[model samples]
Target: MVSRQNIIRVADFIDSTTRSWRTELILNTFSKDDAQKILQIPLTHIPHDGFLV
Candidate 1:
């Protein structure tokens, strides 16, 4: 799980980069099995303007 502090750090980093940057943070919970499946998939399979934590 991404902690609140870590999320804040990421947001701060993004803000420091450029004020014009558009940012969105999402939090989701998944079962252990589902999470394992997700981890097994290559990141290239996921699409987004930003990145996954």
Candidate 2:
């Protein structure tokens, strides 16, 4: 059972990382129940040299 605090932490981490990379993070939750559809997506971009390293 995932706790709400942990979920928020993960979301915050993802948001911070995306901001650092100058990208957008899109989160969508379908429902509020435990069986929720959550997605953390970061927009793709053409990585410069050494960006993937």
Candidate 3:
């Protein structure tokens, strides 16, 4: 399984890219039960560019 810090890092990347604070809130408060849902997201879809890498 991926680490929580890694997930938060992705969330931070998304928040930065979209300038959306909602990502921060979700990352900050996400529960263990929600992790599977987050994992379903394709991190690669954001591109391997520096922004989301």
Candidate 4:
């Protein structure tokens, strides 16, 4: 489970980002599972070239 601090931080970050920047912010900050709740863009899922699955 993500700590309250983490959740709060994510919420704070998301709130700071406008709609136009939300996708980029989420892509930069969250893991796939973490991204689940904050998904705002379909194209931001750049799960990497040699990134381990």
Candidate 5:
């Protein structure tokens, strides 16, 4: 099961993207993964590239 904090973190990450509509569209195009490793990182560790790499 996904944790509440992880959900919030993912949402914030998505919101921080350049365009919400594009972000949502791209996210929807991909299959969901409960083990999104990046989301497991502490917010402080997120890189400037925004984990797009």
Candidate 6:
């Protein structure tokens, strides 16, 4: 049930919370971990446009 509005809300939350220096630092640090998880996905499960569900 993930609607477009939910995506917008999540984007807004990310934008608002990452404005501070500390939060930005934490996000930057964890970005690599996020990338690792994303990159570890199987090719068959990846969308043609590269989005994951």
Using lDDT, give the best candidate's number: 3
The top-ranked prediction according to TM-score is 4
lDDT of 5 by residue, 1-53 (tens): 33334554444444344323223433444445633443344444244544543
Off by over 4 Å in 5: 1-21, 34-53
* lDDT agreement of model 2 with the native: 0.33
What lDDT score goes with residue 42 in model 5? Answer: 44
lDDT of 1 by residue, 12-46 (tens): 32333343212232214345666555445433333
Q: Tell me the alpha-carbon RMSD of every candidate.
A: 10.9, 10.8, 10.0, 12.2, 11.3, 11.2
Which of the two candidates, 2 or 3, achieves a greater lDDT against the reference?
Answer: 3
lDDT of 4 by residue, 1-53 (tens): 33435654433443333323355556566787776665744333333233333
| Candidate 1 wrongly placed segments (more than 4 Å) | 1-28, 45-53
Q: Candidate 4 — which residues are off by over 4 angstroms?
A: 1-21, 40-53
Ranking by TM-score: 4, 1, 3, 6, 5, 2
Clashes of each: 0, 0, 0, 0, 0, 0
> Between which residue pairs do clashes occur in model 5?
none
Sort the predicted structures by lDDT, highest score first. Answer: 3, 4, 5, 1, 6, 2
* Candidate with more favorable, higher TM-score: 4 or 6: 4
Score every model by TM-score.
Answer: 0.30, 0.17, 0.29, 0.31, 0.21, 0.27
lDDT of 6 at 5: 44
> lDDT per residue, candidate 6, 1-53, as tens digits?
33334444322323233332233433444477874554344333222332456
lDDT measured at residue 18 in model 4 versus the true structure, 0 to 100? 39
Compose the digit string of candidate 3's lDDT tens values, residues 1-53.
34455665644535445543344345555775675466456544344445532
